[model samples]
Target chain A: MSKLNIKNLIKSFPSMDRPAVNNVNLDIESGELVAFLGPSGCGKTTILKMITGLFQPDSGDIILDEQSLLKIPTEKRGVVMVFQNYLLFPYMNVNENVGFALKMKGVDKNIIDQKVKEMLELVKLPDIGLRKPKQLSGGQQQRVALARALISNPRILLLDEPLSNLDAHLRDEMRDLIVTIQQKLKVTTIFVTHDQEEAVLLADKIALIFDGELQNFTSPKNYYEKPKNIKAAKFFGGVNFINAKKHNDNLSTNIGTIHYKGENYTDLNEDNIITIRPENIKLSKNNDFNNNSFKGLIKSVIFSGTHTRYKIIVNDLELECSLQSVGLQDIKTDDTIYVHLPSDKIWAMNE
Target chain B: MGGERLKIILSLTPPLLIIFTLFFGGIFYGFLQSLGYQPAIGKYEINFSAYYNVMFSERYAKLFWTGLGLNLWVSFASTFLAAVFALFGALAIRKTFFAKTICNFIYSLNLPMPHLVVAVGIIFVFSQSGLLARFASQIGLIGSPGDFPVLVKDKYGLGIILAYIWKEAAFFFIILMSVLQSLGENFEELAQSLGANRWQRFRYVILPLVMPNLFSASIIVFAFSFGAYEVPALLGVIYPQMLPVMAFEFFLNPDLNARSEGMALSIIIAIIVMILVVFYFWLTQAKIRKD
Candidate 1:
């Protein structure tokens, strides 16, 4: 059974012409970690707010554990959220901040102390309980905020761009910490973020939102391999899109006749496009594949540290291909190359 | 760096000179007069007789003590009540855009109005023969004008306190509105998400977050109300007056020696306010450090 269900949630602001969150629906299982992934102003956070009761949806229901959560107040809903800026109580010390929820419940002081100690240890800041929040580093403050939220043992934990404020190294560290702690606790968690890599790395399932609508909700691999639409594919960094017409079992595009062994697309709209990831498009000196192969001219070569991205033009259609730079021959601009689009890697979607 | 320092000092010289010569120089001359160094009366001998006469002399001891008590009561009551009213006012209006704008404008309308004007308005509205009294009599809540309770010019200094609250609540509201606006609702929402109810959120988050600014604003209001003479002079009773009003009375005396006593009273008022402000800072800073 699902632990939380958001059904047809919609919210609109008077100043905005469109609803901030428009009919978003999801069923998050117990102990599952989900990520609401989108760009800024895409209403991912709005959905989280509605779940926490910070915002009231205009037209739908949020059911948690088979109970309607609309009638319950925020404090009683047992849903905790960690903000991006780590809104730790500025006036409380670290120990007080972590144990604040328990203290509010009139929990025993000794138990609160023991639990705070454990939480501090969990977040790996055991000795900084006496320090003020402002005294901690940005990463440490976020850790403390996470500990504070987890100490309460909420039914659903929501994090809003928790790692966005950290530097590159700290972001990686915090990401690892979040995964470790979340798996250990086995608590249902949902986080909102714009970074695709963070969502893919942290979430069991990623819900992609665009313009206040749910674009796709599936595993991260599915997003990269079988996105629901062009927007979803584009958002997941799909750069090579070829306008194609699907016949019985293959797609005919400007580049070539693409042989794809996938689900039948008879019910799909006539305006269909085939997309393949840049990294999946194979580049070699000669034709190596019997199907979906084409000769292309390399228009540009961008050698980023780990990979070389090439903009190749084939049959008047531009295609991007990313190749590993470790053992490659000296590939430069204007080089003629053979591009192969693997049958299994080609994803077809309506325009 | 040296040239920049010289430039800053040169730019600051005019205001510094004005403050030192006009403000501190006047205070220094007052201190001299308070110690009985009145060259105008051919009494150049500096002594503590004027302070003794004002504080310990039988003719003025009762007056001074009662005036001091009234001053403390009025200042503390007005500052506390105004702060509480303004806090609730700011909280109530902070969330609504249209209402907040209108209420904020109306609340701050009193900020620039003169204290004397507010005192006079209080008199017209709350005095025995005032508008409220006449309305109450006409509505049969009271028998006549004389039946109305004496709110202005009463022994409890209620009128003076009311005037201060009216003027100073606006000052506090302005400060608190800005503070609450800058803080936004992130802290409160965080507390709420942490299972804190409305009262708990206010107690733990909102109150503590605004305490430092509120304390500073309170200090200003307290000091001003304690030392200001106009409101109390316009609204106070004759016998048990506020310290400022009583201090001003001494200056009206025809005797040249009485001028020293007036200056002594003024110096005492200033010293008391300074001590109270320092004590307030110490108390709040200790709490802040503990937190």
Candidate 2:
């Protein structure tokens, strides 16, 4: 494990008006497994490529242990990447592919063989050493790619959406396998993913990127609960954006005036907005629960397996609230329910 | 089932019939002639005298042997050199922006040029009395044009080999460029990340992936260069000619019996090319299966 410092990295393609990776900076600690989480074309992959020296930054410095990597070529930098499609060498079988790096470094045949065998056993595919990549399943090929990248004992490992190509069940299994291998190897890894759930599951810290900038770089719990902006909040799922007027400690919206504790709002002139996730809004029949409770009519009910999604209308504001489906079978459309918005849960942001 | 079979045969008959008549008919007639049956010269008996005469007879045996040797050398050298040069050229210009387009245009520009024109072009530029030799004399590189080296019409068949390499390198370039473009840079990039240098990546990853196409394209260039008569006939020494040139001379003889010998020599060249292509295909297939 090694520390990777990316300072002021910027890259732009000739055909694109905006830079592909705009002035991005990240400091990865030793033995940390961080995920660059964002939607497609959000510059997550670009950041990973820049770190691995596959794509050169227009101007910036990538330092590993205080040593700048700008002068180093890709193969000499000891930074390996497992591409999104698992780009295994078609001419080589699994053993040769995994042992390619050691062989290139002029390792002995017996040592390369031993290391390749160890990698295959670590990846749990000890019997597939002689099978070509095309003959392996997508999951098996992904394992081979991981084995190949990790066999070199690289300073930093980069995974470019490695689980995007597998089926749902295989993706779950591969996710577990990757995390286990990552822990066992303890290599400082930066996993680029667009899937929020996968990011939450694997990353010790997640860097949420959007439009070539880091929106939020924090733990998965904080990133999900307290996103930096509306765009980051909307990435998780249904989020309600309320145009509200701030009055000292309270904000007035179309639904009702609620308690506001965030510091962004100052006066009536400020464009204060209150955003809350659907699962944060509690559905109740009693009105004496909280100061932010309001009576709303249930507009529609979507019966998901784990929870019941209710579209409620309060005044002119249409709101979505999900309640766990424990005994909510009696609830139907047009039922009047009191919705509670917690004072701390409502994130206030200035537009 | 019978109706479907009839429909399949009907769909296949046009091309199959044309191929059989043109290909099999030619082979049959050539084989019969090689067996020494020529009614025009009133030799109606079937025998292998023409094949024997071409191989061992005192009159043409030395000429035939030397021609075969020159034929093999020129074809093998030119094909191997062309394929190697084309592979490097394609790799160098595979991803550049301006140079890629310009080099592709220039590379393909030579494809439509005939072998006869290329051979004449080589003679015009490389001969002792040619433009380059005269230019060297004027520039004081040589005292006179006669001081220029003998590159054209030399006994080593250098002129013929140079002509084929110039023309057919473009041919192999077209084949290799398409293969490299389709294969893309993803694998090579992965190899680089896996600690492979540029030369290592080309040798292990790029070369192996493109080998099958290169081999197939080489077989085509080899077969053409081996049997092509125009390039060598125009730029070859008379003493040690290529096989096709010798065969053409046999056809040019007034004796009708010589026609059988010419057909027999042509058949021999074709059989050699067929065997080589089949062997290369089998070798590549076995290597692919083993891995």
Candidate 3:
């Protein structure tokens, strides 16, 4: 059996008649770090709770390591959930909080101490056992929380927006620490976040969800490069769209005639939608270029440190593009310029 | 003739005049009376004897000790239990459960219905010849009210404990739920992942995050339980009456001199409660510093 398998998981709050988590299914490999990526309120946390047995599924089967996990209590699920806020016990020192699970399982004191110490070291917070959670900073609290969860040596780890609390720099540090800990432990992990970049950076596989529906389950590269829907396409930063119309054979877009790279859809016809990446659009000083090029005025130029972003207006089409700051001419606002779109790079999408 | 502060002093005149007349008047009146020279009471003789005599009396000692004991027991018991129940109740309802909806509904039922209603409810349930007695009799254990086991108003103080627990715990629970809920679900989930069990999660995660609220709720609980009159008077036993009951009895005594003695007893109760409040504040501050 798969390390973790969820089939038709569902949950609903009392205020609503509909389920927050509706007919969700996921299959996790033994030690894969999977991310459930979605915007806020898309039921990612609800799914995490169901996996940990914190919330019982309205209807579903969860098989963990070849055994049905439906009847398993949270304590017995062997999956630890790391929360966004890092809820650590106020009463106990770090060591006591980390060692608590062993104490409940009737482990010996010496063994518990050894395990706690090892887990602490794994989180790289050695000899800080006596310190309470309130004594630790946001990052340290996060690491101690990680240590406490890993101390049980569970088969799977569930993290729900764990790094969203910290400042940007600390968030990066904690994410790296969590990744390092997960690598060493080899435990299957389900990390949930709305941040697409985080999902791309961390997960072995990313599940892109939108409006409580599974949009697509694929690798980060595939999910980013080849999005299944407009929502997923927009989730990655660089996508831009322009006017397009399809004819017989090749599609006719404002960029030029581009052959479709995606699967041919039965619903596709002469009227179609075109998608282009902002990075793929090339700009030049040559107004003489014909077919794929358009003469436009720079409506606005924004300096964004590493790269400059430009909003270009050409006839009826207004497009946004970002360019490398190096060796690029400083085009003033409303200056006439030539923007080129390569036919291969613009995908004509059929609705 | 002014350091540019004259306008500020002039601006303060209306409110300060009212406060000075009202507040300081009471203080100065009390000060004069405590010295045994109350012109309004017709004891204009400036004497130290009334103060001297009252200070050395055995009755004052009884009043002081009784107030001290009741304040300590009621405040400590109610505060400790209210905090524990609030923490557990918040955690229990944080996730959906079978009885969570109903329990939460009851926990949020009107709080200011006077402690007397709760005490009466406690009496109905726990008193001999009550529902428990009827059940016991039907089970062939007892024939009548006399044979029924005693619980409410018993010398053991179980009735008062139950009444206080029922009312104050729910009070604290409301405040604590907001605090715990506001802290959000992330912190606790993180703790669970850390290998902490249900109990450990409370100890390490929920407790720390909710401590400030818990401390504030306990202080309110302590204050109310320390000065509590209705519940203990109605449901509490008679032998060593609770501080408030004693203070009330003295205030009601027919003898005119006893009114002064009653005020003295109340003063004692007030002092004791204040001391306890200061102590609880100190303890929490120390704990925070340690953390």
Candidate 4:
């Protein structure tokens, strides 16, 4: 296992004025799986490509175990990527594809065969070595790609949205398979994905990127509960923003003032934005629940399978509130309700 | 079902008749003549005498064998070299933007040019008294134009081979460019990441993916080059003429009985081309099955 460090990496295409990857810095510890989570065109894949030596960075250093990787070519970098389409060579059988890297290294045939068989068994496709890639299903092809990538014992594995092409059920299965194999091999891996759930489920730490910048890098729990910015906050789930003016200890807003006391702010200021998650805001008919409670009208009720989401109109501000469908009574639209905004859960940050 | 079948036959009749008359009809007449049944010469009995004379008889046997060897050499050499050069050209300019546009323009510039014109151009540029010789003499690189290497009308058939390659490479490039464009660099990138070097990537991945198209395109080039006359006639030496040129010379002979021998040589060239094409197809099919 080797530590992968990316220091101030930047890249810009000649066709575009703005750089594709802006001075991004990241440190992936040895044997840690980090997921680069972002929307489309967020430079996740571009950064992955640069790390793998497919794309050259305009400036900065990719230090792997205290050595710069910029001078090394792609094949010598010991970084393998499982492409989104699982680009198995159409001319080779599954075994040949899996053992290609070893063959390229001029390994003995008997050893390569043994390693390829072990890898096939590891990916749980043990008896289909002679079958061509097109003869396999989408999920089976994914396994072949995985086995091929892992058979070479790469220093760092890069997965470019490996599960996006699979069906929903296959996505879950492949996700589990990847995590299990990643842990077993203990290879330092970085995976790019637009799906937040996959990142959270598979990564030890998630790096949220937006518009070619790393917005936040932390654990999945921190991303949801304690996001560093509005962008990272909105990525995990829905967030309702309200403009507020801070006065010493109390913050004044359109939904009425509340004694706001979240630790996101150090000094009380005039201009601030208050963001709260929909699931954290409790809706009830009784007013004696919490300190920062307000009377509101339910504007709309959306009944999802897992939960019922309500849009509550308080004064001129609309706040989205979600309640679990289990152990909850029917909440109708146009009904009067009291929405509680917990002080600690309401995160206040400067605009 | 009978009515539908009749409608289908009616719809296909016009094309079938045209193909049978213009294509197969010519082939049938040539085959009859090749077997020594030229009515114009008053030789009505159909036998294998014309074929035997063309292959083994004293008069035309040496010329026939030498022409066959030249035909094979020109077709195989030009096809192989053109396909290899075009594959490299296509790969080099596949990704770069400015180079891609410029190279695409230069690559297809000769596609619309006639082979005879290209042969004439080659002579003007490559012959002993050509522009290159003049330039070399002007620069004082050699004593005179005679010191310049002979590239055209030489015994080794270098002039005809060069002209064929220059013209046919563009055809191969066009086919390869389309294939390369449709197949993005994803596979190459994957191979690179999987520890395959540049040569390995091309040999194991890029070549195989684009091979079927390359083989089919080479077949067309080979068959065409084997039977094309104008380029070879314009730029060839008289000692070992290409098969097509030799066959056409037989037709021009004053003796009307020689027409059967000419047709026999034409039929021989056609058979060789068909055999090569079938062999190539069988090889590609076996590869596909193995894969």
**Highest-scoring model, lDDT:** 1
By descending DockQ, how would the candidates be arranged?
4, 2, 1, 3
Query: Between 1 and 3, whose DockQ is larger?
Result: 1
Question: What is the number of backbone collisions in each predicted candidate, taken in the order shown?
Answer: 0, 0, 15, 0
Candidate 2, residue A300: the lDDT equals: 95
lDDT of each: 0.92, 0.88, 0.75, 0.90
Q: What does the lDDT read for residue B269 in candidate 4?
A: 88
Candidate number with the higher DockQ (1 or 2): 2
Highest DockQ model number: 4
List, residue by residue over B1-291, the lDDT tens digit for candidate 2: 999999999999999999989999889988888898777778778988888999899998998999999999999999999999899989889996866788898977888998889999999998999999999999999999999999899999999988998999999999999999999898888888889999998888999889988888888899999999999999999989888998888899998779999999999999999999899889988987686
List, residue by residue over B1-291, the lDDT tens digit for candidate 3: 595689888989989998988987765555555455655557676655434444457656654465457557766876798678767877779666788879888886747767888888888877886788888888878887668767787755667877788888788888888786677776555545444577766665667678777777777777778777888789766665677777677558775445454555555566766886799889888976887
Model 4 Cα lDDT, one tens digit per residue, A114-215: 999999999999999999988999999999999999999999999999899999999999999999999999999999999999999999999888778888
Give me the displacement of residue B67 in model 4, in angstroms: 1.6
Looking at candidate 1 chain A, the ten consecutive residues that score lowest on lDDT are: A262-271
| Runs in model 4 lying further than 4 Å from the true structure | A245-252, A257-261, A267-270
Error of 2 at A346 (Å): 2.4
The CAPRI quality class of candidate 4 comes to high
Pick out the ten consecutive residues of candidate 4 chain B with the lowest summed lDDT: B93-102
Off by over 4 Å in 2: A252-254, A261-270, B1-17, B288-291
- The TM-score values for the models, in the order shown, are 0.96, 0.95, 0.73, 0.96
